[model samples]
Target chain A: MIRVDHLTKKFGSFTAAGDISLALARGESLALWGSNGAGKTTIIRCVLGLLSFEGTISVGGRDIARDGKRARSLIGYVPQELAFYDDLRVWEAVTLFARLKGVARVDLDATLDHVGIPDQGGKRIRELSGGMKQRLALAIALLGDPPLLVLDEVTASLDVCGRAELVALLGRLSGQGRSLLFASHRADEVTSLAQRVLMLEKGRVNAEVPVNQFVAKLGAGSVLHLHMPAPSRALAMELLRGHGFAPTLNGVGILVPVPATQKAVPLRLLAEARLSVDDFELLSPRDASLGQENHA
Target chain B: MSATALETREAVEAHAPGMISNVLTLAWRELRDALRARSFLLYSLAFLALGLGVSYVSAASTGSLGLSGFGRTTAGLINIVLLVVPLMALSTGAGAIAGDRERGMLLFLLAQPVSRLEVVLGKYLGLAGALVACITLGLGACSLVLALQGGATEPRTMLWLAGLSILLALSMLSVGVLVSALARRASVAVGTGVFLWLALVFVSDLGIMAGTLAMRLPVKSLFLATLCNPLQAFKMWALHSIDASIDVLGPAGLYAMDTYHDALPWMFGASLIGWIVVPLLLAVVVFSKRSPV
Candidate 1:
């Protein structure tokens, strides 16, 4: 759905992205993974025709630099930061983008339902929670049903539940044969929605790995830190270890790494063992720094 | 092509809206946003108050509640209009792109299948619509006040003032958009706008005098300077149309009247129109270059 070759972007003396090239097939999902300032957003911007670079980018078939308007017509983009007219109601915002994209009014109703914000049609944008606003952005992006979905850290600002729900929605969209090219640092988001992960470091692509190998080789996922009493911590660690988990005892918690989808497995095991925990925090994979290691 | 493939291709082509439709959609949204803004309400009320207050105070000074004509009433209102209207236009137009760019809204808006030229034209048209409405409200209220005071009021002078105010507003708006396009930060854009308002309204003549003294500049150059400032051009046009005399504008006015004679008004009109068109065209060029698309 999208092809990029020799894409190098520079700002004066500094290069933001260097000679990056990648392509995604019609029904494929690809991710650009990196930390802050790793040039993921820069690559996405180049593909979206929002930057002048020394290379070529094409969406579907149109050259982005030569035919940007028509090239962009094939993409539904969701930016990382949410921006809207605060006074506009949900329906009005949808209608505005709909009209701009030549979307019929009948489909707007269906899009709202598709994004799970049908009841929020009348509420002003400022009245919505961050999650609902993100959903509204998604709905706006989904308009015209563009063949390609280009997202830049879309769930970064969303809470846990909101992030999961949006990931699931995107997963469904991918299943329906939509091409997704997203940039994300969060492993759960990357693992949940992307089929192939492109690891980016300081404007260079270090490696491109399939999702499963990405998981096995890097243990790239969120880590659950369960805080409990000192006595309970030791017992919890031992029990978790027996259940195929490598739980370690920290100062006041047992750290367990698990696949993003199975985050509840350790908690379920603890519950079955009648173990009570005081509290827990899940450290997102973005903080893990595993992707920063050079693969040679 | 297969039947289904042909149908899909046709659907894709139809999905891209024309430039006019995109511009209008964007313009309507800008207008709606302006209407709902607190500043718009405040600006309207300020205009109404300025209009009514000026008329009432002018009438009372004449030792009667009733005024004779639009001449004196509008003569009193012109200075305030010159002071307030440009500032209002500057404040509104300076935020057109900088504010959106800061909030990341500009990128999102440009991500759609629309061109940057269309965005600039749409925003300019929408803001022009808003400024026209405000100026009309103020001038209309001032005329109504004169009519209510029970006298033979001349409607033509008020029409001239309305036309002049709209032109002035548009001219200042064009400059503001140009500033917004050039400045990277919103605060910088706003500061530049206010600085422009001050230079045009208060400092243009004083600076001209200072320059003339320091460099011994000729009167012709000074006249050109006065005409260059849109605010000065607007004032000359307003005063000449209302009182039918350019002598009140002092030497520059007298010099222009003597030099240009019957063509002076058209010259002022042309200057105002030039101010309106030049900055806007420059802004379009700058914006198209500045933005990625």
Candidate 2:
């Protein structure tokens, strides 16, 4: 549904994204996986034709540079920032977007229902929770029933449940034969929704992996910190070690470095060992580095 | 790319709205927002009070509340329009793009299929509509009072002032949009708007007067300088409509009358229209040239 060729975006002396190329086939879903400042959003912006970049991008066979308005007509974009006029009621906002998108007819209730925000038409935009706001952004993106959806870290601001719900909704949408090009750093979202994953680092595409093998290749990039009784901590470490896991102890907890996808495995092992975990925290690669800094 | 993945150009174009539709939709939103804002209510009330207050005060000398003709009421309201209208226009227009950028709303709007020119034109029309509403509310109430009190004489003068005031508001609004498009933040746009207001209303006049007195400048130079400021251009026209001699404008007015002769009104009228059109076109160009980032 989209193809990017040798795309490079630079801001003055700094390159935000460099020589990244990828494609998404019709009805297929892909994720740009990277940490913050890793060029995922930059690549997304370039694809959306929001930035001037070297090389070329074509959406639905139209060159974005030469035909941005029509090329964008095929896309429904949900930017990372869920910004809207605060004083406008939900129905008014949706109607306005519908007109902008050239949706000839608007069934406000149906669109809201699809995004799980039915009956929110009377509420002001300012009164919505983070989850509802994200849902509204999605609803706005879905206007005109565009074939492709370009989402930029849409669930970053949502809580755990909100993220899960949105991801499931996206999965359903993808299942219904809509192409999705989304940028996300969450392993679960990628595994659940994307058919392919493009790993990004330092403004370049590091690797492209099939979703099935993505987690195994990502390695032990995340860590789980289990805060247990001091006596049980040693046993937890040993038990985790026997399970082919390497564990270390920090000041307040036992830390086991694991692939993000295997976060639950360590907990499952502790439960099998009957070692109670008082509390636990899962640190992604970025937070893991911060954890190391604190330990140092 | 697979054939199924690519949509035909015609198919894509079918989903996109016409430019006029986009502009009108955006304009409607801006107008609605202005109407709902607290500032709009405050502005309307202020104009209403100014209208009533000016008419009553002007007629007080005649021992009645509405005995003063439209000529006197317009004469009394001209200075307030010169002062308040630009400030109102600036406040309304200065926030157009910059405020949206601050709130990230511009990104959402731009992400749609609409062009940059559509956004600028739409905002200008919507904000201009609001300003017109404010002017009409105040002046309409004043005219009604005059007619009821049997002082509706010189209605043409009142209409002329109303037209000139609206023109001035629109001209200043164009400048404000330019400021909004140039500034990255709302606060900076506001500061620029205020600075422009001071230069047009106070600093420019004082500077020209000072320069003329200190350097023995020609009447033509003084006249040209006055025409360059939209506020001054408005004041001269408003005064001319009330008193054709334009004695209130002093030497520059006399010079304009002597130089332009029969075409003086057309010249100043075109100058005021130029003030409205020139800045708006410049704003559209600058806004269209902005990087999408």
Candidate 3:
């Protein structure tokens, strides 16, 4: 649904997005994962025709630079910061955007309902919580039912439940044959929702991994640091292996590699063993890899 | 067969609205917001009170007033309008696009099918609508006061003044929108717009006057020099309204020329058109090329 070819953005001597090329197919959910200043926002802006850049960006077979208005009409953009008229009610905001998108007034309520904010028509923007505001922005983006949706850090401010809700909404959107390009710094958020992941570093597409493989490589293996009260390291190791953990006896503690999916199984096994566990911590492998990458 | 055909017709009948209607709807929303704003209402009220006071004082002081007396009264009112109306237009225009950018609402507006030209025109028209209402109320109140007194209040004069005010406001608004498009901050746009207005209205005239005096120019040349400023066009137009008996096409045509005659029409029209077109052209160029934040 979208093609970005060697897109590069420069400000004086600084390069924001450098020679990045990627494509997203219809109904595919791709997440742009990166650290801060990774140029994700810059790339999104270029695609939106907001910023001038070198190279080409095409949306739904139309070149954004050549036919910006027509291309934009086929794409829905949800910016990181959910900005709207604070005084406008939910319905007013949605209807305004619908009108701007050239949607008939009759379709506005249906669009609002589609975004899961059905009964919030009269709620003022200021009165809504951060999650609701984000939903309102999503509803605005979805006003014309565009084929492609671009979301930037949409789950940044949401609580766990809200993030789950948004993930479910994204899943449904992708199920409906709509392409989604989401950019976020939250690894877990992307891991749970994205089908494919694009990792960026220093304005470059450093890696592209399938979501399941990425989770397996980065999340499948985790470190379990356990301190036993009785200093029964050998017994703890045996108990850990019984629970499917690759355990190593180190001094008075046990270090184990636990598969992420079996995280609860090990904990349950430890509780069943009745071992006096002084302390335990689940160390995510992705966090460790990211730290090493940063150090390198 | 009939039911199948009915379903096909129903599907075909589902239509979306056109883009122009959408732009107008958005523009109407902006107009409503401006009208409901306390600052707009307060500014209009202040202008009305000041206009009434000036007209009342001018009418009371003059006795056995001839065409010259009427000319003076109208000139005073025109001066007030030219000075105050541009200031109002500048403030309103300065915030037009920059404010939206700051609040990030510009993204929401632009996300639609509206082109940059449509956005600029819609905003200009919306602000112009509010400006017209305010100018009408203020100018109409002054004209009413003058009529209540023994002064001659011509309908044509009112129409001309209103028309001139709109042109002037549009010009100032164009300049303001240009600044807004260029500046990253609303305050900077407002400051730059105000500075440009002062330079165009007062500073440029002062410079021209100094140059004329330095060259030891004739009285006629000095009078003609005033025409270089748009405010002077307004002043000349006001002068013609005061005394219609004066021969506007004679050698001393500065005072004699009809306010709407000959080159004056083209002069105001060009100035107004230039203000609307030039800045907007530049704005489109800059906005299209610049990256969205």
Candidate 4:
């Protein structure tokens, strides 16, 4: 429900985001992947009408530049840096934002409940942990029940469990026909959570690919290491067949190059072959190239 | 009911607070915060006490100078209010917008549906309200002391002084808000506002005096130059209200020198009002165009 076209944001002489174009549809989850200072935040700020940019941003069919109030009304935003008045209580902060968004007083409690902060309504903001504060930020963003939500680095400082919880919440929200655009540097988190991924480098989209396809292409050439009971070179040779790799057996270990697609196939076949395998493990290729690509 | 009527009814029910209500709400919060701020309250009270003490001392010492005690006391009190009140107003107003920007609260406020004009006007009124309250307390004390010493404290004079005080407050408040919009930091805004106040009140008069002395110009010209300064207008207005005989700037005062002295006050008042309006309009324009950094 959001569309951005030729969006360029420049600060002084530097081009932060140049000629970026993208669209997000209802019930779709898209991740904006980029390194630090890659214009992800700049793009989101342009959509929120928090910055002046050379482009058109439309939210839910309304142009943000011409009709910002209506556009903002249809969009929810979770800023990268969580900022709120520390003196306000959790519920008070949420309620204040709700009121600002034109939500009725009666719906405030229900909104807080929906964000899983019902019991935290009376606690001060300073008393909350990082994860709880992040949840509070989400609650504030969701105050008006906007149709589209833009979260910048939604899982930045959270522990594994908290990140999982947020990802699950986003998935559920998408299931309810809400559109989401999440920006993050965490590959595994984005890969697991978003349906489509937009990888950015230096303020430009480097690759836009489906998550499964990205995983398959990025997951090529895994190493299959086998630990047998004895020097069983024959078992290793048969296991390496059809994967275009000859097995090298040394002592009790066997090494093979198995294509990522044949990972499960060889493992299942070996188990069914009744070979006395003490231990076996499949290791994917080291992602040093992915790191270099991100830096580039 | 038909579907159109039903939708209209729902739309009416879902409407938020109007413009006036929103401004009033924000203004109320600002006033509350000002009242709760210990430093502001203490500084205002201290200034008031100091002003009253000066008025008392001036009234008591006037008999030795062959002047009427009551008139001298009333004049002293008026002068203090006129001179010191604008400085207070300017200091408070200068930081309103800049301070909010520094604290990063302006973005949160601007993100709402309210227009930038509403925000500026609300803040202007709020800070002005607090300044007026402080001025009233100081004026009331001066009035009590004047009454205790059998001074002629006319209601009209007091009313004129109050009006002039408000005018000065509005003028300075507008300038301060403008400076706040222009400056990069709150500290810079406040510093520049104080510097502007001093320049108008003290430095301009000094410069006029020095030029008059060096050029051998008539004292009347020197007096007329004071009118160029806004603070001088406020001073002349207060002096005129207290006593018609005493000519602080003489007949050549800026107010008198203006060919339209009769119309100038109205013009000056309009100009002051414009001062409040123009910068605020510019601020709204700038703020709307500005990206939150």
Candidate 5:
């Protein structure tokens, strides 16, 4: 459990996180949702006790300033940057992190297997694909099975499949009763993993609500991604457009913007046309990684 | 203890540190990073090449490729190690901290349960490890060539020179770590390291030479001033060990011998150790005060 009271962070004259107070209950998953420069990272940094802030913060009841080592001991962190060391093998890096975190015993093989990277222990970090690197970062975060996990932009660099797989793993973690505090701009990730979403705007916690209500209240639309074989791409786009939806071709598949009100209509139209979607997720409007938001 | 109690105890132990273990782990990472760095390797190899060149040249000139030839090579190899070792140490020491900061590695490391002092000490020791390895490789290669040519007599003098050079490298590494901690950017940190090297190696000597020519200070004062620069103190100490009446330090050594009597060697040794300690403590202070962001 993490508790932050009146947390305010400032850089000279500009406030990064202003008067933001929130608490993440034990075994309760919470997500910080914000656009760029919205103080999402500042809030997380404050919770991690990395920044000088005006407030009280504690992890598992121990104050960060008074007992920082113990407070940090209760938390596992996955930073935004996936770099540990380029030359170290995947398993070696994990072992080093476990030691660095002072974890008494961690089954490196089990940790790697937990992240679906069982054999990457021998492979160098630089040799890993983006997905594997992210997975390795997660494996490192899971060391000693710390009670709290703080992940910053977890799906920022992953492809759709990688994102889905990671989201599923996180969902399992959520179900197993580990406190999760994640920061993301992706509404879909918030919906899938976060039980409660704290919407931040300009260093302020503007709203805190359940993910479904948060998306519904904002009238934000979700983007439907259709993954078909190359030959069926044109037919799917035509079928989508015929239903008065805007369709765009991405590298992997065609993306159709579906508003919350008419979300059912588009999916039914796709079904009616027999254009199969291999996988799909209701992408929140601010899912910046998937594609640029369409204001039009 | 019960199973849950045992788990709690291990978790508590994992978070607890009086700083030694944390520093060692960090130092190990630092050593690995520095040894793999191309700049550290390049500077070390340059020292190595100089050592090889000096060994064979001294052997040829002495007309004896034995113990006498190896002893003679020390005089020339000392200068090369003095110049090359500091540069190599700077690259590894300053580059390690600055690169970590720039790449967000420091932030990640600090986010763990370790304290700020642990990070600095770990990095310093790691760089020291790399520097020692590099010094051994370079100076050892030259010695190996001499031994191969049947010259193995003056091991004591050879070792003394190598030891002083290691001390010299450590002194500069401390300065480099301080620069790396204080500077905001990696490029700036490296630039400061180079400038410090230039100041200590070239500028200080040139300034002293100019001042001495202009003012004509007393011999004792001049001698004290020369020892103020670690490189000069190191050079004097290395050569003085071989020839007591060595005129390499010009008038300072001779005059100091007469005026200071038994205290001159102690002064040189103290100055070299001072150079190593002062900057390193300053680095620790700065690191402890500032956030690792």
Candidate 6:
């Protein structure tokens, strides 16, 4: 479990994290959703007891300021960038972390196996691929079987394969009921790993919603765009309205916002009316941003 | 029950390792890095070569009948150690704490449960230990060769030079760590290290000359002024310990000899100790207070 209260961090004149408060219970996963300079890393730094900040932070019921070692003992941090001694072999790296964290009887091989890097123990960190290095970081964080994991932009720099490997590992972590507080700019990562999403903008919490509810909200406002023969457009709109759908004419097609409660209403209406369409496009909110990304 | 008592009780119940153990862990890591670095190997080889050359030249060039008190062999070796050992130690220490901070390794290390003070101590121990090991070994080799040369060897002088070299290295190392802590960038730390080496080794006399020009100084004051620079004090101690000439010191040469009575060696030793401690403690203070960024 982790607790942060009135945590405001400032670097000179600029405020990084402003009067933020949040709590995460054991077996829960919380994702911080923010873009660049959104103070995600600053918040994590404050929680790790690395920064001088206003207010208080506690991990596993121990105050960070008064009991840093004990609190850090409960935490396993995976930073965004690669952090390792390049010459150290996987076995040595893991064992070093184990000792630093004051773990007892560290099972280096078993720990690496848990993170899916069983065979990498013999190789130096310099020889590892980016994904392997990332896995190795995960392995290091997982040393001592820490109850909480604080990951910062962990999946941002990975390739597709690496991302999947990390995602799979996170899924396993979630399954094991370990608390996770990760900051990410990716939607899929939040959906896959976080049960609850905390939307952050300019160091302030905008919304905190369950992932399923957030997904439902995304679907509720999505427009189902379709075009029929111009002659039957009126008839099609009439049929759509009959299903309690408000359709707006956009260019040659009609856009309808489908609510999650009305499951299969669009298809049912289309099947019933038998309206042949020239084009159909379901424009979701995410797709709009994704399209802008590609265009940019 | 009082609140403070409860707090103390709870604190004791939490079995985090003490400061010494934490420092040991950090020192162990720093020592490993020092031993593994390519610069360490290069520095060791350079020392050995310098030693071999000096002692070889000493053995060949000496008179058939042993001449003088300290012999030419030690005088040459001391010259090498005085200049070279500080350079080696400064290079190591200059990068010690500050270089790691620049390379972002400090972020990783600081995220652990250890305190910043412990980090500083560990780094100092490791670096100081490393310089001692390499410099001593090189001096030992040089002394062995000088002894094998079979005539007019000054064992006491050799011992003094070896200890002085280690002390001088430590003094430079403290300067390096201090520069590292003060400078934000690694390039800046290294540049400052070079500037310090130049100022201490070549231009030290300039500072004393400027002071002498400003006001008249007694012979003792003049000698003390030169000793203010650690390298100068070390040089004076080395040459004077051989009971040789102070002629190379310019203008105040005979005055330095006249004024340098019994307390010269102790004063030199004190200056070296002061150089090592002052910069190092200042570094610790700065490092402990500042953020890793």
Models, CA RMSD each: 5.3, 3.5, 6.3, 6.9, 6.6, 4.9
The candidates' interface RMSDs, in order, read 5.2, 3.6, 9.0, 6.8, 6.2, 4.1
lDDT of 5 by residue, B1-293 (tens): 33233234333323554478788888898888888888878887888889999987787677655655665688788788778877777756677677777777787777777777788889899889988898888777887777666655477877788789889989988888998888878899998888888888899989888888899877767787888999888888877777764476668877877777567678888998999999999998887666676
The runs of at least 3 residues in candidate 5 whose Cα sits more than 4 Å from the true structure, single-residue gaps closed, are: A220-262, A265-296, B1-18, B64-71, B150-152, B214-220, B289-293
RMSD of 3: 6.3
lDDT leader: 2
Comparing 1 with 2 on TM-score, the higher-scoring candidate is 2
TM-score (chain B) of candidate 1 = 0.90
User: DockQ of each model against the real complex?
Assistant: 0.33, 0.42, 0.29, 0.15, 0.26, 0.35
For model 6, the chain A TM-score is: 0.77
lDDT of 6 by residue, A1-296 (tens): 77787889988989999998888988899998888888889999888888888987777766787777767777788888766678888888877777777765777778888888787889999999877787888887877777889998888888888898798888888778789999987777888999998878888887789988756754576767676778777888888898788886655666677775554577668777787777776677566445445555
Q: Write the residue-wise lDDT of candidate 5 on A64-111 in tens digits.
A: 766677678788888776866788887778777788777667887888
Which stretches of candidate 4 lie above 4 Å from their native place? A90-92, A106-108, A122-124, A157-171, A214-296, B1-18, B55-74, B82-84, B144-152, B211-225, B244-246, B254-261
* Order of candidate numbers by TM-score, starting with the best: 2, 1, 3, 6, 5, 4
Per-residue lDDT of candidate 3, residues B95-196 (tens digit): 888888888888766765667767777777788899999999998988888888877766677678777877777777777878888888888998997898
lDDT value, residue B52 of candidate 5: 90
Clashing pairs in 2: none
Q: For model 4, what is the alpha-carbon lDDT of residue B142?
A: 73
Residue range B128-232, candidate 1, lDDT tens digits: 888888888888877776666664466777787888999999999999999998888788898899999998888987998899899987767777888888988
Displacement of residue A134 (Cα, Å) in model 3 is 1.1
Question: Please, what are the lDDT tens digits per residue for candidate 2 over residues A1-296?
Answer: 78888899988988889898898888999999998988998888778777778987888777777667777788889987689899889999999988888887899999999999999999999999998998999999988888899999989999999999999988888797789999999888999889999999888888999988787776557778888889888888889999999998887788888874677899999998899999998776688667777888
Model 2 chain B scores worst on lDDT over the 10 consecutive residues at B2-11
In order of lDDT, best first, we have 2, 1, 5, 6, 3, 4
Every model's TM-score:
0.86, 0.91, 0.85, 0.78, 0.84, 0.84
Kept native contacts, as fractions per model, are 0.47, 0.54, 0.40, 0.12, 0.36, 0.29
Give the distance in Å from residue B14's predicted Cα in candidate 2 to where it truly belongs: 5.3
Q: Across residues B193-283, which tens digit of lDDT does each residue of candidate 6 receive?
A: 9888888887877877777778877666887778788998788778777766566676566776666656667878999999999999999
